[model samples]
Target: MTAPILEIRNLSKAFGPIQALNNVSLIIPRASLTIIAGPDGSGKSTLLKCLLGLVRADAGQIYLKGQLTDKNFEQIRSISAYMSERFSLYPDLTVEENLDFYACIQMVPKDRKDDLKHRLLERTGLESFRFRLAANLSGGLKQKLALATALLSSPEILFLDEPTPGIDPTSRLEFFRLLEELKKEGRTIILTTPYLDEAEKGDEIVFFHRGKIIKQGSLSDLKNQFPLLVFSFEPETNIFEAYTELSKLVGPENLILRGRQLKIFVPEGEELIWRGKLLRLKREEPRLEDIYFYFERRSEMMELGHDQ
Candidate 1:
């Protein structure tokens, strides 16, 4: 059997009184896209930083290529590239210049630099904007440029943190397409995003909440493991009125408002009770967001029970 490309074992970290990571362990197979998804302060960034050796973990071990050694740091540094939430490319330099500067800093051999630069520029669709100043590029274009710079070194593992936050929908779609292309090139990509739809694109997803992984699996696995039945309704009356009535009947924990529609999750065999209370009700497949919230709420309830 082939070994995983990257592995984390019992990893933990803390900040003063706050524990940032709690016994987190995960495995990344070769040439796959893995997404660590959660909201802010869920330790997504901290986990990525630990893998890059930029943030030291208070406990646990990291293995690369199935080997755990004291040289793990050196190995990871040499073969990995990280694009943080704020990748600091020189604002004054042109796109091409920024790539060249990073290539030089990474000590890419002078003989191979030009060919690598050409390929990265073409691959990232930055060829036309090569001479454009970094500060003047659009948000998506700047992100593409940052990715181009990160790729200059030709690292085997790529880590990204919230790479698409606040970008327009069109740009986000384009960026994900680029990532799919990179994955096809046989590089292992690990990234974090709060966007559930974006996270759905990955081969495997790890859902983090409050310093812990609540669940990890492919989309199908997640849906199968979800413990509730979901139903969507198109109300005949005012949407807000429908929501209020449904919230009272099923409690707000089971209800979600999506534009003019309302969705509710109820236990098995309880669907009829809520279906009778709304119009145009239909059983629907659970989305990644629904699955995430289910696990998150379950974890909270479990914790609360233990406290009591």
Candidate 2:
């Protein structure tokens, strides 16, 4: 693994009775993209905010570039950029104008400002849309502008919180392509996303659930660790009806319905039963969603046991 750019240890945060983060610790590798994946209300957003000092962690320390800076994040923030879940740039400002505004805010050197702006605009494919108001741009273009603005500082690490939600697939693809280029240029990216499909593209994934990281690893590593076999088949009957029937045989938590296709988790010793019930079932590789669902349920079960 590459040398770590950021190290977080025993981080915790709370909002009154709700614990937003619970004893979380993670090492973010240098020059690679590490995805924070989880559902809403999970600690993904809170974790990012804590790292950037937007929200203070109640406990634990954050080390940036191997130097502890829990009390002051200025040094870390200086070398990093963040794009919030919401579009933070001025919607009324033209794309180019927003870039200029952020550039000035980041204090880009006068000699490098114009050149950097021009290059980012071209790189993000926003050169032609430079004169368009941010509000007038499509969902995709707005995101592009936001990204270009974030890059104005030429950050070493970029933190994005759900950058692709509500974005069209085509635009999402373009946005990720730009990220890949950034990674190739040796920039570390830490992104929080609810979409597991998007998380699949990262070098490492940190899976969170209800204020804690339940799993963290590379895609293949996680897949190899998955203990259950996934059997998928298109239901001959109505999907929901089939799902209901299967729910009785195998818990609903073990089933995933995708359109007309039904996927079931076949336990180590139950392959024969599943295969007998679904004549056309085929064993398939588990997708990232499958892995997440499995871990989330397992975590919930363990929590229930502890409570009991």
Q: Candidates' lDDT values, in order?
A: 0.88, 0.89
Model 2, 1-308: lDDT tens digits are 44479999999999999999999999988999999999999989999899889998899999887889957989889999999998687988999899999999999998999999999999888999999999899889889999999999999999999999999999999999999999999899999999999999999999999999988899999998888889887876788887888877777668888877988888765643442663556899988999898788778878888999
TM-score of each: 0.90, 0.90
Least accurate stretch of 10 residues (summed lDDT) in model 2? 271-280
The 10 consecutive residues of candidate 1 with the worst lDDT sum are 271-280
* Residue ranges of candidate 2 with Cα displaced over 4 Å: 1-3, 233-253, 257-262, 269-281
Residue-level lDDT tens digits of model 1 in 103-219: 999999999999999998888889999999999998988899989889888889999898998789998999889889889999999999988888899999999998899999998
Per-residue lDDT of 281 in model 2:
67
Best by the TM-score measure: 2
Superposed Cα deviation of residue 130, candidate 2 (Å) = 1.8
